[model samples]
Target chain A: MAETKTYREALREAMVQEMERDENVILMGEDIGVYGGTHLITDGLIDDWGPKRVMDTPISENGFTGAAVGMAMMGMRPIVEMMTWNFSFLAADQIIQHAAKLRYFSGGQVQIPLVIRGPNGGGVQLSAQHTHSLENFYGHFPGLKVVAPVTPNDVKGMMITAVRDPNPVIFLEAGALYGTKGEVEDGDNAVPFGKARIACEGDDVTLIAYGRQVNLCLRVADTLEEEDGVSAEVIDLRSIRPFDEDAIVASVEKTHRAVAVQEQWRWFGVASEVAAIIQDRAFDYLDAPVERVSGAEVPAPYARNLELAAFPSDKQVANAARRVLYMEEK
Target chain B: MPAENGNGENGGAEARGEGSVATSADRLVDLYREMVTIRRFEEACQRGFRQGKIGGYLHVYTGQEAVAVGFLDSFKEGDRVITAYRDHPHALLLGSDPKNVMAELYGRGSGIVKGKGGSMHLFDVERGMMGGYGIVGGHIPIGVGIAYALKYHETENICQLFLGDGAMSQGAFHEAANLAGLWGKDGQCPCLFIVENNQYGMGTSVERTTAMTDLAAKFDAYGIEHEKVDGMDIEAVLEAAERLTEQVRETGKPYAVEALTYRTAPHGAADFFEKYRSKEEIEEWRQRDPIGILENKLLDSDAADEEKLEEIKGEAKELIDEAVKFADESEQPPIEELYTDVYSGEDEYTGEA
Candidate 1:
């Protein structure tokens, strides 16, 4: 029987299991020890493993982040939390300049088995400063692996793989999905990165997304099938850096149309990359231009109504799918 | 507070003539030879830059050789070293192959980093030389992190992080210093912060950059032990490094050493105007040149004759000549190599997008 668990529980399970497996695996971040993390995802971990393993750090993002990179080089696996993805800007130099490019620059003499993870995407009125969708920002770099797992199973499985992988990983967790429940397989369910999960199979149009947007795409696919009588295929691009272009191309070939979605701003966003890949590899199979549904181009506002409008919705995803299928108005 | 003389406890008379950390007469001669090699290698770099053979920013370690050599001399096995862009000397001192170092500057596959890092990003991991970072103050935190790992792994070795006077103003330096100070309390951090106070931060003098000219005093804010050393004197730097490095290893605490020195060369090859400081000031610092002090010490102490010094110079010249020949004869990295090494699991990746 499949075991059901929340995203938060699954993430905590991943860390707890890894720490139990390897003594070198340690967790470090602000409030991660005493307060059990800013999101409470690491709740009771400190009590379980003590302060040395679940380290509590000061609010020195660049400092702790760079320290984790150094630890990784010395054969220690460090899982550094950013508290929020917005605060990661403080550690961008360490993350991008040092962590991402160290192994390549060092000619593969060093391997950074480091994971920098935290909640991302704008929702719940976090406003401009607190909210960010950094998949595109992190994925743009070559050496780093960027993974955005949508479900509890994917997050738990991918976290295991990320900790074990001998390269730095940017694990962008969705804050809104922490409480979302999903059926997760127990015991050694490590998911391989760069593989896209086909959430639903259809023939009319392909709905592509990742992270929290995958849930929206799944819901939209159902709506398209029931209300609009259109069968929409949904593809969850779990890993962004090692992009699953073959899976996307194959899905687009079957569907004959595609609609990319992202919570980041429209310009130069993850959707832009997805649309480009579809066009590049599945150009002949397309009956119409691939439509893109992305977050509005504005700093995330504080107001509830405005914040809701800032990000993509099921309605928007369904409309974009219709547009890709040439069934909705231009 | 003004910068005080670093050799008070050790006594300048004993430390200056005979290094406190057992600098045998032969070791002093060897150190002098290493310094000479760095100077000649950088001079070759200048000529190569003029001829358009070496591309990108070339920041040489001509004036601050003693800081790298003296401090690195104290490094034991398993000790890791990280520094900023003025890195050729550090790599050489830490045992990076001269041929690979020169070939890296030439962007050849035979270079230490397979010509990918170029001048600013030299790395010899096997020798525990972590990297030569391009960004100012960027490697400071990484240095602290390395120390944390060393302690966490229950290793006895420490990490030496090198930054410049200009990097003192960066937030990363302060943040890293604070973390080092905090982590050191638990005996989990053994990192040494070495600031190469080369009088200028790429044209901005130390005096103009900060109200507090004493860079060592800044470490007090982070609760780290701080001191200033006479960087021009190799013996003084070695004495300080020996004391501080031992303290770091014994206590597992971070320490800061501000080596007061001057760079005779411009910040980079492109920065030639020397408009930032007066020529008279330049000539004055040049008199206290690190190589000159060691050479004079070697001569005055009767450890070596002028002929012996010249012989060392000739050996360095010959080694540099071989480095240049190897770099010139080395092949360029193939176009296919550009795609490799980005990710570890190459076979698993399709390289499709």
Candidate 2:
């Protein structure tokens, strides 16, 4: 059974269900308790679980995040809210150095069942300091499990899986689409990591993305089918670190061409990895070179027009698909 | 509250209203033996580093033995102990096998943590030695969290968080201290912050690092009660540790103890240039060396004769020698170990492996 839910609700439900299912699961973040969370994803949760489980931490990212790592090491499942992925840079040392490496450094003596989730990428016009797409940045590390879920269903399912997983997970949410509604699974809809979700399947060309960019690719897939009679397959790479190379290779083998899209800079982004993977694994099946549609190389701007311009557009993804399909520029 | 003593000076036995004579001669001898073992173990490490038998940066707990030995004496079964890179003694005191510790330093598979964490990063979770972090201030918040969890679990156990005077300047320390104080209001943070004031952080002295030289008083900003102890004196440290650990455990609140001691050795094995401090300063601190102070007290109290003390030293030497031999003979970690322990369970490693 499934019910319609907002992305925010699905995320909250995952945490609530996990917390209720396992007493060890706790939530800690800035403004997550009494203030009802900066995004209200954990709103009203403190009333149910109380302050011990839904904790409001100080603005010290490194301190609280490191504390979460400690808690996880001591057998607590801590789900930390980053407010937004941009602020996670402050706690990068803890996340990258300790949380990501402690288990390996300790010779697997400790398991860090920890999750750090927050809004990612630019869409609400929060500007440069407040906006970042960190899937590739975090996915670069080996020990971390990075997931960027676009749909409410995947958000809930992956979060459950993340909370249950023994390793640390970097949960990147579609910040701009928090209120977007979708049919989410009823209960225990645990989605495994390292698997890509086939959002829409077609045969002409493969469009690859994750997070909010997945929505854009879906829109682009529709436009490509309606305007150019090109059937585009959208592959949502829900998991980044334990990436689904076989899925991309399989899709590319069938489509014979691919367009990798991302809302991050073209250099060293997830799209680049997709392009690399397609070339490395399915080079013989390619009808043309893989196309990459990426955001403009600029820090996110506060002005809505500039912010929209900074991110990859539906028209851009559609044109990239057209290029990979060897069709008209329009 | 224990009386805060003057900084960088030995707090005499009379300061705590205790005599030099220990109540139990056997216990004093045992403590003396443990301290000697640590000192000998550290001296062997220096030799290993010089002989190229040990790799990576090596920080030994040479002159600051009393602080760990004394404080760890108060360690309860469920309690946890965490510290920075200079963590050999904490592991030893927590009952981690000396051979495994030495083998870890030797980078052998038989080493604790399978030689993954070297001198800077030792972990014996079963013994309540949570970890020995390489980063100076990185482990402060972690220790605070461990304490918070202990209280969260409704246990009377506490976390003995040991850090250097240098780490007090880090934002992690202050932030964690604030959290400790905040959580402690409801008696949820039973963290015992043991500030091992070894004077210098690497090469810079604490005086040069922070305007407020009283490291213990800094905890006042976080509402955590703190005091200083003559770190060179084992009895003074033991007195503070016993009182503070119990207080933290019972109250479920955080406490701080700044043990004013000095590291008579260089900051690292390769730090041969003692340009930071003069030989005179080192010699002065050495006169009040923790081991020497304990030895003098034991001799004065008639706990043991010179011959008996020599026997203890000889035994410690033999023990450390055996540890070194075991480390020397132990094999390197299997190549497959490189891929293991990245994550738990099946598919433990990612990537090519």
Best by lDDT: 2
Interface root-mean-square deviation for each candidate?
Answer: 1.4, 0.9
Tens-digit per-residue lDDT, B183-287, candidate 2: 999999999999999999999998899999988999999999999999998888887888899999899999999998999888999896378899999999999
Query: Which candidate has the highest TM-score of all?
Result: 2
lDDT of 1 by residue, A169-255 (tens): 999998889999999889779999989999888888999999889888888888988899999889999999788889999998898
State the fnat of candidate 2 relative to the true structure: 0.72
Docking class of 1: medium
In terms of TM-score, how similar is model 2 to the real structure? 0.97
The clash count for each model shown is: 1, 0
Model 2 off-target regions past 4 Å? B1-23
lDDT of 2: 0.90
Model 1: clashing residue pairs?
Answer: A67-B145
DockQ score for model 1: 0.72
- lDDT of model 1 at position A55: 93
Tens digits of per-residue lDDT, candidate 2, A24-61, equal 89999999999999889999999988999999999999
Taking the tens digit of each residue's C-alpha lDDT, what string does model 1 give over B1-353? Answer: 11222222112232144345656567778889999999999999988888888999899988889999999999899999999999999999889888999999999999898878899989998899999999999999999999998998899999999999999999999999999999998888999999999989999988898999989999999899898998999998988989999999999999999998999998999996468889999999999999998877766655666777778899999999999999989899876667666667543352543
